[model samples]
Target chain A: MPDTIAPRSADAATPPTPRMSGVGRVLVAVYGILALAATGRTAVQIIERYDEAPVAFTLSGLSALVYIVATISLVAPGRVWYRVAWIAISFELIGVLVIGTITLVAPDLLGAGTGNPFGRTSTVWTLFGAGYLFIPLVLPILGLWWLAKHRPAPETTGASATSTAVTPGASGAAA
Target chain B: MIAWFAGVQIAVAVVGALLAIILGLLGRKPSDLTMGPLILVELLLIVQVVISIVAPLVGNEPSGSLLEYWVYLISAALLPIAGGFWALIERSRWSTVVIGVVCLAVAIMVYRMTQIWFVQGL
Candidate 1:
């Protein structure tokens, strides 16, 4: 079998696979792995030593939550789930940048006598998202790219233009 | 030792990644590698897991957080197995991406394992 799975071309009358295919599939798989990673780390912190760095530990928990949501959204089928995954991914991007920066220059704030106030700040975002060698940093960029690959319809001229009027270059009044 | 084993793992990952690249260039999809080298990588992972589980019992802790080290090991082993399955089902350029990610992940694990194995810092 060729297994090309037919990329969603403009010619296609039927909609593309509602669920992930191609790169999206692997993306989801990575999310699943990261979910496992973050979940395990957070569980360990909470159960073994919650007092060591509560702030860092809390962020780990939050990241874990985001990863779990992303993973579930990635694996499950449907438009609603896709939107949820997008939301989780967006939050992941924000979390990594914000937390990564905070832990980097403001080590004194997130750090502790134990060297980690939030239960040993071991999050995907800490240190400019270096924990995953910046993949935590790059994932959002790739996500947006993958989302773009779907080539959602131009919204400016659509009947529901009110919803997406703000879309870039939507106003074709001059044209 | 897991550290030594990691070096070998990296070597294997590089090879797997290269194969994925070559196959991708040839218009071969992820499904092409599903039953071939991909399975071999999974087999290597199984061996890796066994060695990792047994390593601590037979020897002293490497140096860093042993739990953390094992976490990397366990997850590393699972990467290709799950990734390969997903690739098989999806069968797109993404399979090549999976191989790339696995290679990257293994390299990172090797680096972390090295840090824990040799370094004493937190």
Candidate 2:
């Protein structure tokens, strides 16, 4: 039996959800790092100066939480977990967009001496996440793409088909 | 915040990154050293934590609040621990690369913490 990440073919064979692929593994690790970075920054900002900008700081904290939840769900092996991860990743996309827009439009709402208000210079979502070249902005979207690629469907036998398909006598190479 | 122990830990981070690259290039992992880097870092961090706690006791740091400095120190420790966790679980060449990058990041964060500790800028 092969691991759950074989490439797709159409001979009535189905593959299990990919655990870690060439790209997915790197993506997961990147998300994990971002989760920690954002979480720490949010925590420090809130603790050091919650009085400064409650709205932005609280949103920062919220992004941190979503990133953490997405990281865990994406990495763990389960159909349900992957779906759950997609939801969190979707939230990240929306969060970055919403937060990114508000900061750009209403800079004064951040107040002076807010310690890098948008945190775009430091966060996973500043300048459309340009500090990370919007990779942080794009990560969750890719995660959803990866998740959607392998999600079980009405026709596919899912992982069970993959194990049998991996036999030496059968076509064994992953796509 | 504790300079001596933190300095030694920076050296460890550099060494850890080097080790990871070497192992990864060989298509191997320092399973032996997988836990080694974290252990050394944690030990040094514990020592640093102790100093941050006792800084007020020594009176040299009376002007600086022990609480905030301690928070920074604690955060410094968590970085490598989380990196090590991901490194061990993945068991791939990229894991080694991730470890190397994390060590580099740790060195920078440690240096920043030391600067904050001494300057104690309000």
Candidate 3:
């Protein structure tokens, strides 16, 4: 069995690491939902009343784009995708923090003034996502942690090569 | 929207969330016990959709932005289906928790929907 499986591993090379397994799947599920939500909010804000708060609506659109990218990157396979996930999630964290603080301290800057035509301008990161229960603030942190934990094995490393070579045989045996 | 029906949906969603979370804490994988509540929530959401369509025609219109109300309702309906698919693919304790979280979110969204229908007008 080992002889047959070892040859198969060599032929297959290193199979792309499973990023969407176990806890990561849960992360992706949350990300997908957030992506859907941000996109929906952006659509409504921009299409319904873009003129009322252009800056705030544009910011909402930007967050929607970020969420969509992050969701896809987290689900895609390969090292390139892993790097993309890192960049997108990092940007999301920064956006949430910066926007959250701004919304809290000087919401008028985002058109949250009482006299504004459309109540307060809200986004996914508004007030650290108070409207959405702060999930926006927390999700990127969790995503960064998940990415750090699931770093792809270095392809050039002899040790990693040996481990990858061993995995298939073990899986084959379990099968 | 009928007040009692909305109240019942919220109650069921909250109960479902609590049940799923408890099962997850016990380290239980995806099972009928975990999925049942989510399915029930989905059914209630379908009912909610029907009500949303018929109520406005019957002179019970939402006071808020109609687009906003429908978007929230549609998004709320999708959450459970997505969570259930995740649980089916990855049968784990965490997936159970995900279902719970989704249910809780649905409850909140449903509450918001009621608020839109009854109070807020744009």
Once fitted onto the true fold, the runs of candidate 1 whose alpha carbons sit more than 4 angstroms away are A1-16, A113-120, A148-175, B31-37, B120-122
Per residue, candidate 2 scores C-alpha lDDT tens digits across B1-122 of 45687788889977876786566556665365755775676677778777777765776462333444555566667766876787677677766666666665566556656655665444
Cα lDDT tens digits for candidate 3, A142-171 = 999888766654445576568878889797
Model with the higher DockQ, candidate 1 or 3? 3
Winner on TM-score (1 vs 2): 1
Best by DockQ: 3
Worst lDDT run of 10 residues, candidate 3 chain B, spans B113-122
Expressed as tens digits, the lDDT of each residue in B3-112 for candidate 1 is 56667767777777777766655656666553455566567667867776777798755666667667766777777777667666666676666766676566566566
Q: Provide the TM-score for each candidate, comma-separated.
A: 0.74, 0.65, 0.83
Q: By summed lDDT, which 10 consecutive residues of candidate 2 chain A come out lowest?
A: A113-122
- In the order shown, the chain A TM-scores of the predictions are 0.71, 0.69, 0.76
The TM-score of candidate 1 is: 0.74
Give candidate 2 regions above 4 Å deviation. Answer: A1-17, A21-26, A78-80, A97-108, A115-175, B3-8, B18-26, B33-35, B60-72, B79-91, B115-120
DockQ of each: 0.23, 0.16, 0.48
